[model samples]
Target: MCDTTPKTPIWKAIADALRSDLAEGRYTPGDKLPTEAALAERFGVNRHTVRHGISALVEEGLVRTRRGAGAFVAAIPTDYPIGQRVRFHENLIAAGRRPEKQILDVEERAATDGEAKALVINTGDPVCAYHGLSLADGQPIAVFESVFPLSRLAGMASALQDTSSVTEALRALGVNDYTRATTRLTAVRARATHALHLQVSEGDPLLRTSSVNIGEDGQAVEYGRTWFAGDRITLTLES
Candidate 1:
């Protein structure tokens, strides 16, 4: 008797081949893939089959399709650790990627109820707010808003204006060190502001982190919220 096992579909085979190529670094992140017609000609298949293969890659988060720009390799998510001492630049550097921070806005605002609770301050107390973008290898990874008690860190705004690093800014204001005291994470849909900042469409997935940092004296020094692009970062809990 002859074996009668079914064979894999050509489109699935194509997708497998592309996935292998990606794993082998045949195409780097952000590289545009061949056009559908070109792939079809190369694989001896129809355009519809090529489209199906591309769709599979999209579902697997290995490729992204633009309306007129064809498919492009998706960026591999960076592993970002959440720990007592979390430094964005140090983390990216350890991952062999360049890190950058862009300070978007800075202002002094009255603390909201949540902010006051996180920072252990009065609800109407003034706080210095810093809004910024964090990037790895030129791609936006997260948008962050950090609030500090103005009475404690009066020069935080000026320090932030001079440098993009929040740690450095705090250090400049005589805070030698701070550690993460608490963190809460949730999955959320990107809003208009977040989408614009992260270069993603509205309703795209985002990882939201709300955290509090404390000084050696065990007093809350900062309250921060960060919205990470879902496809660009993998959050890790560190011991």
Candidate 2:
């Protein structure tokens, strides 16, 4: 003789299946899930069962349903730490996200007034400008620009192109180490280009950071600004 416990409910099975997909990164933040009809077919259940299962996800804040559109995965803000020694890859790795960058532009340019002030250089002095977008698990999260005094960091552009890492590039230029000497954070609205690059609405909130990095000799090595998607990052200050 054989005995069996009551089988799991079909709706709960659907919910559990979808939850696993979300947890394993199959569907990232802001991604649309399968339509109710599609899910119902896949699960071999009725639409009612599918809707009931999805409702559990909505209640748990893992997914949101739009009246006419569809269910979408909810965004969970990634934790970012602000401190003297800040490394983008390290921070994202610690948060369990794959970090990546798309270098948009890099060139030697005349330092503007703001750049001069931040880098302690005269206006019109040559500077290496590096621009890029940062992504977390394939989601655009921030756009950044870093300016370096070209006279001090010769061939900076080539180094950045080779490494795509500020720390490694600076090291190639003979700057052994550096630390953040100043950090000024402000809340701002995304501009047209920023909005386009970050896939956010124009005028959406953005977290802006203006910072300067100093080398072991206490000389300014980098002047940088980063605009982060307001809804995608939770910045924390480390004491």
Candidate 3:
């Protein structure tokens, strides 16, 4: 007697099937998936098997589990460009998302060693620092701290108070335009404060960007550090 049968785990098979459905647009981004009971009945499997399948999807970032609400398809990441003319509002608008910013703190601060080097000012020089949270479609996406040399942009703090945009504030201060001079990126785990602002669990992934902006005359105008939710935004580098 010759007997040959294919051996594959049922859970993996279910996962594959669900992945296919996702690829075929059966479940679009942000769509709620069927309940475990429904999937178990449909697949003629136990709830545990269905749960295992969903767990695979979650690991793949194709689905997100909500407490007491089952699972839902994850949102497509917004394409954010890091370019010479990086504008947060413009970037989110181009990605078809509504952009919003909340200014958390604005005050005069003495420049630290790093800020002094970036801003071409002496250590302890007066600098205007702006701290804010950026959101896309009402979901917090990043937190930013931007420092400006107050000697050059003396009214920057007042300008920022009237607007939620750094670009606008700089423009109000007579800096018609600025270009990204340098950017250094690093991957880090979200700390407690970062997690609270981004609405993610502690130790979740985050992208930290440290950058400097230069004005038309090639003077460093702004030094900024931003922490972005790794799952929400996809950083794209431009030439």
Top TM-score: which candidate number?
1
lDDT winner between 1 and 2, please give it. 2
Q: In the order shown, what is each candidate's alpha-carbon RMSD?
A: 3.7, 6.2, 4.1
Q: Write the per-residue lDDT of candidate 3 for residues 1-239, one digit (tens) a residue.
A: 86678877889999999999999999976678999999999999999999999999999999877555678777788999998889999999999999999999999989999999988999999999999999988778899999999999998999999998888999998899999999999999998898778766678789999999999999999999999988889999999
Best-performing candidate as measured by lDDT = 2
**Alpha carbon deviation, residue 190, candidate 3 (Å):** 0.7
What TM-score does model 1 achieve against the real structure? Answer: 0.82
Error of 3 at 189 (Å): 1.2
lDDT of 1 at 38: 96
Report backbone clashes per prediction.
0, 0, 0
The stretch of ten residues in a row with the least summed lDDT in candidate 3 is: 66-75
lDDT of each: 0.91, 0.93, 0.91
TM-score, one value per model: 0.82, 0.76, 0.77
Over 1-239, each residue of candidate 1 has an lDDT whose tens digit, in order, gives 98899999999999999999999999987678999999999899999999999999999889977555678888889999999989999999998899999989999989999999899899989999999999999888899999999989888889999998888898998899999999999999999899888777788899999999998789888999999999889999999
Q: TM-score of predicted model 3?
A: 0.77
* Candidates, ranked, lDDT: 2, 1, 3
Model 3 collision count: 0
